[model samples]
Target: MPEEMKTLVVTGLRTQFNTAKGPVAAVRDVNLKVARGEIVGLVGESGSGKSVTGLSIMGLIDAPGEITAGAILLNGEDLRKASPKRLRELRGDRIAMIFQDPMMTLNPVLRIDTQMIEAIRVHDHKVGRQEARERCRDALGLVGIPSPEERLEAYPHEFSGGMRQRVAIAIAMLNRPDIIIADEPTTALDVTIQSQILAQMQKLCRDTGTALIWITHDLTVVAGLTDRVYVMYAGDVVEEAPVEDLLDRPIHPYTDGLIRSIPSHNAPGQPLNQIPGITPALDRMPAGCRFHPRCPRRTDACLEEIALRSFGPAREARCIHPLVEG
Candidate 1:
């Protein structure tokens, strides 16, 4: 067996945003890591801070939002303290992000070839347009897009939703980046399309040694695509474990709830189990255990803030009364 190269490591990362009332914590004390050729799933509901964590790592958090604590280390380099110039230099070349909507990455008017070629050239000026365009075509082909040459001359509007997303992914891989933060890139696609994309993504990362952090709310996706899983609730990670171990036995109540809510778990005509309450608002986050209000296993001990504690060598949970049994 060989050791995998660490590509991204996050420690105690806290990102907050300013609202009219006050600062709202979007990501709190998050720690995550991904090594070359590995896919890690960051799973949670919509307001669970998974996407914010991704944005923070990519240095894409806008005004009124900022990283207040912790470190985002890219192969031991701290991203929080990195300069604007340095961050820009790393963005497309070393690290790339595939946004939820392809439109967020693609220009409405520009040809696909124009956009992708420029993405490559901007990072390394030495790569000529012809060379970059060839790479762009190859990238598109790698993602299962057909007629790569003709597609390069097409505009974003010409493609279907799934195809557009495949293009966005192709551009992200243009530089053969060390890491990619994918923000629900397949959520809008049909399941058939989603599966195709997932297979291609897995193959791409394995072949190229790109580490991936897939931020999504879908448990089934995690089951199929990730090696490890992090379950977040109310801006904090409630559980972290190897995918098979976590799936076999979810330690945190929130994680258990999420697993139960997956569509596959429902009876043919029965309603699915829903988590009891909404994720607490950032400003209105509950004291002590953020998930206490909705957790079935919450106890008086949950009234005090619980630090993430390990259950086994590779498994950790934030709940004091963690569910250790299957």
Candidate 2:
């Protein structure tokens, strides 16, 4: 929470999609901060706009989805106003991203060595070919890839699913960037591989002092891997708090419902709690509080627009009838 320790600051991010029906606000009024060497988990369901928020920060959104309003600041520099050339220069060198699919970051036709060495060359052209190749091998080994030297000669298709993911992650960490945005990088892997990758990522972040934004729908993964957590609902951050505080005592109804829905939290033989109803369509968003319809504690007060209110030190929630008693 200290000002000096903060590495990335994002505020008032609004991203909308232009569709035939009209403009759909996929992300709205979202604000979050990641401290140096800290990992923050952005958790929500499939259509909660978590991925859109990450893409917006990375400046990867295309014509249909545009970031309309917001400031994305990386180490005090405003990324929103940066020119295309500036963004390109800063992207892979200072800020790297590990996408959900390895293919997004890897080219099937190119050998691993070519892609990785090119990445290093782009940032440090003075480094010789031999040194760059050595760095590429080191990067591969850092991600737990075995026989990295020989593997470098193989194409992406030759590696297994988990191996491909490891290669992609290695590429992201090659530059030792200040921040890494990982969007469900482990969602498709088996549990053992997931655990290994998560541990490696955590160790890398701690050792290299890299800030990380891990976007995922799995609360279980977030509980173990993140220093802090932010719950997104209907394109807005409904709650934000330290990991322990949010898990132990969530302040918002939406947060409570998500925690309750986790199978591990239910009593043996008891029916699992499920939040009914789907996320509201962005174009047809509700007039008042976006969550009012499904909230068990909803009342007439919920019929008015609500903004996030401070709950305690470093904790905030947006709800007319908060689940937690003050």
Off by over 4 Å in 1: 1-5
Looking at candidate 1, what is the lDDT of residue 239? 93
Worst 10 residues of 1 by lDDT: 1-10
Determine which window of 10 residues in candidate 2 has minimal summed lDDT. Answer: 1-10
Candidate 1 lDDT over 1-326, as tens digits, reads 12224788888999999889989999999998788888999999879999999999999999899889998888778888999999998998899999889999999999999999889988899988889889999999999989999999999999999999999999899899999999999998898999999998999999999989999999889999999999998899989999998998989988888888887888977999998878777888888999999988777888898999888877899988878942
Candidate lDDT (C-alpha), each: 0.90, 0.91
Best by lDDT: 2
**Which parts of model 2 have CA positions greater than 4 angstroms off?**
1-5
lDDT of 2 by residue, 195-217 (tens): 99999999999999999999999
The C-alpha local distance difference test score for the whole of candidate 2 amounts to: 0.91
